[model samples]
Target: MSSSDGTAADASWERSDGRSRPPPTVNTIRRIRQACTNCRHRKTRCSGERPRCMNCRRVDRVCHYEPYSTTNPPSSASVAANNGAAKGKSPSSLFPRAGVVDISRLPLATRKSRQSSPSHRLLSINIRLPPPSPQTPFPTCQVQCMRFTTAPPPAVMDHLIDAYFLHVHNQPYSYFHEQSFRERVNYGLIPKCLLFAILASALKFSDIEYFQGSIREATEAYAREAWLAILHEHLTVENNPTLAERTLTLLTLFYIGGRTSSGWLKIGLAVRIAQDLQLMREPKNTMPPIEQEEHRRAFWSIYLLDKLVSVGQSRPPAIAEEDIHVQLPSDEETLRRGIWKKTPTLHQLINWKSETESSVNGTFTQTILAATALGRCCRYVLHGREMDEMPPWDPRSDFTLLNTFLLLIDHHLQVETPSIPQIVEHYRRPDGTLDFQSLEHVVFARIVFHTAHCLLNHPFLLRMRLQKSNCKVPPKFLTRSFQISCNHARSISSLVEDAIASGCHVQSSFYAYASILAGGILSLAIHIDQEKGQVTDPETLNHYQKAIHILERTGRRWDHASKMVSLHCLFRAIL
Candidate 1:
């Protein structure tokens, strides 16, 4: 053989000798079995320690292994046997029976058994088990049921309830008592529909945009659920319609938050229900003090709602003054202390002396009384004389109704005047703006009074203008009434601006209504000045602009504000 060929053979032999040989049989190294089922499902690395693996131990999961079986499939009869053996045993507890043990006691035993088991034993006994039932994902838990029906988490619910009481229930005309309401909510005694209504109303005032969206959704859901619940209860329940009254009240409040006309209709239903419950009449002597107080509160609340709706809508009041025999509510302290004092009627309250006074000095009760009186005057002005009955030809007959309303106004002023100075002293700020938060009841009362005054006198002023056109001199009372009405209009506009400047959260509807009324009057005054070829007062024009600004601000929260703005524009154009 040539040396080169020998060298090549030697080199091949040397390379073969230097390189390690592959396994003779090419035996496959089994992939190390994956960690237990849980760790594998979680896609986490597992220590592969037998029995309960490290990952499962850390998370307290049921660590399990699959048993190795031959590649040949099991017989159907063996499968049937296994199924039969598993009968009556829960899937979780299908291991060999040690005894009928309480599952509660298994945890300690499980830990000890897992700790004491030999590694070899754990590896040998790879008991296969069925997969766990599918779990609800965490996000799905948030909206498990209908969003409205689902109870909020306890902390969130508590916060909402607190916000409702703080911002809503403390309003001058609101009726809810915080302590009783909280107790009812905590005990889950409030019906779900009513609770949702309250939540929707409360959330309307939340500063958060998320909560505002929630309010819109919740309000729609509440309307559906409330109607259904009411129908169901009416069919299934026997007497006692107290729930109906409460549900109606909550529905009214929800509508009120939106400043919808539907709130007035809801309040009418609430009034009828209250009447059915005998809440309009004085409570019986035999009734418990708390029950009596509750009746008084409910009745007056309905009365307050009637006034607010009537004035806001420019409609006649649904509740009449004579029909309300229930007394004013007692102070919170008096009610809380369980002291039973003889509640007084409106007449008696007007005549109350220092010696005879009970603790009826509560802002809520006082405000209701003032509003009720103002409401009476408003009804007379709006609907007292049926125009249908009036002779079509006589302008003189119009003055007859005006004269009577003026007397009623005089009576109210006389009774209410004594309290006005005190209210002014308490609420007037150093900057001459009224601090509405400190005296919301008084501020609202004054606004209502002035609104009624302006409304009543406006017709007479129009009459005076017509008479002036006919070359008939206007009566002294007519001219005086015109001047007084203009003064009241200016006063209302100033008060509203002051309220806005002071950062008071007065009801948007109230301020909006007052602004439109005042603005209309001031605009009329400007038109009259232009007709006389006199220069328009810049101050009056400025006041009208401010009133319009208020309406625009109110439009953000109240639907009625937009309507009022449209109406004011039409009226201004006509003038």
Candidate 2:
């Protein structure tokens, strides 16, 4: 019965529709899913993976696996063939079209040579990044890409801004209109460049405990952040030119960066930008009164920088006083209240010798006037405008005219030289209010006033003036000049000492050198007295020591001051 049935089934199958029903391709002897088709063809071990195996995935092939039943078991021969296959090795060696060599079988020399060839190696890539630096943890690109949210807390920023305005803004650097700046700060509209720049310089003056121990490092760190912000702004490239000007000047006004060679360039760039905006010229009458006052303030600030940064005549001031058509800044009350008044010019002040005409100028205008006079003195000294045929002793000489100009400046400002120097007291009221703007004006006016006299009586300039002249200089003239210089130098030191003691430090950058110059002069005078066989008095020695001490304190805040302190020649007689 079985033979007859099998014969009938075989005949039916042979005559079956071969197109409709397909036959099993393999003998089905291999165990189910023991190997994938690709792996099996390469005689390699399979991971028994579902859907797609690693070997198939690597080659981008469609994967297929045969099914099994519990009722039926696979042969041991199939299992053995799969088990002995190569493990963890690429099956590319089995196919000529794979285009990858089994480098493990290659000789040592050939493998090493191939290993060194980037083109011949596998296509997989490896990337490595450098560790962060200790000083600047974030690169500019990293900060930009990662979005640095790590600025000083808003409270800290408020204090820093206060420090800047109170200590820094009062110097001739009063380009910022306080009302507008404070309004912008309240709105959180200030730029990071300007914000960070203020923080950088003001950290030294800050009372924040967070910045207490490491003032230098914190200041430098903020400066670096400000630098990054400035570079980032450059990408936007002058979208806010006023902000750019203010930020650069704020940085130039206090940070060490503004004092470097680069800072000098920044000064020129800033002044040029201001000039481009017609800040060098007077604001038109059609302009808003408040806006006109703003432009006037901004121009005066830049003008002061020009005067202060001029290193004698070797580096001439960018703003020629003759070229300046803008008026001096308004009264502090007018500026604070937005009440703009047109102030007078240097020429107008010089001509006002009439006793009946009380000057309408405030202390700030006096600062401008004093700085103007100082500019003349620097140019006079550095230009070596020696009356070669006529001695400086001549009453009609340019030197004598300059001396007269200084005295006229004193007269216009109504300056009374007090016997014992007193710090400016009105900057703070009875209830602990700071009239910082007024204070800055008064303090800076005094400093620039004294600095001018000190430079005028500088022995260096005196020698030059006497060098070229054939006239016999009077010993009395020389002694009087020396005494005047010593007196003014002492005055400068005393002003610094009393101001600091009163919790009102002078905020001007020029004070760094002014204090040093004063100290230098007093030291020389003491030694000169010693050379004349007179013993150095305790008061004289004490004054010199106080000057050095003040300088050391200044050095902690200003990099240039530190260098000045280190120079042995700066205090040659004492050293």
What are the models' TM-scores?
A: 0.63, 0.68
- Encode model 2's per-residue lDDT on 391-499: one tens digit a residue: 6678887678878988888876655543223424444567876676776676677778788888888887788778767578888888888878888888788777876
C-alpha lDDT values of all predictions: 0.60, 0.66
**Candidate 2: worst-modelled 10 consecutive residues by lDDT:** 123-132
Q: Compared with the true structure, what per-residue lDDT tens digits does model 1 show for residues 114-187? A: 34644313322223211222363433222321334344444446667776665566455455555666666655
Q: Model 1: which residue pairs collide?
A: none
Best by lDDT: 2
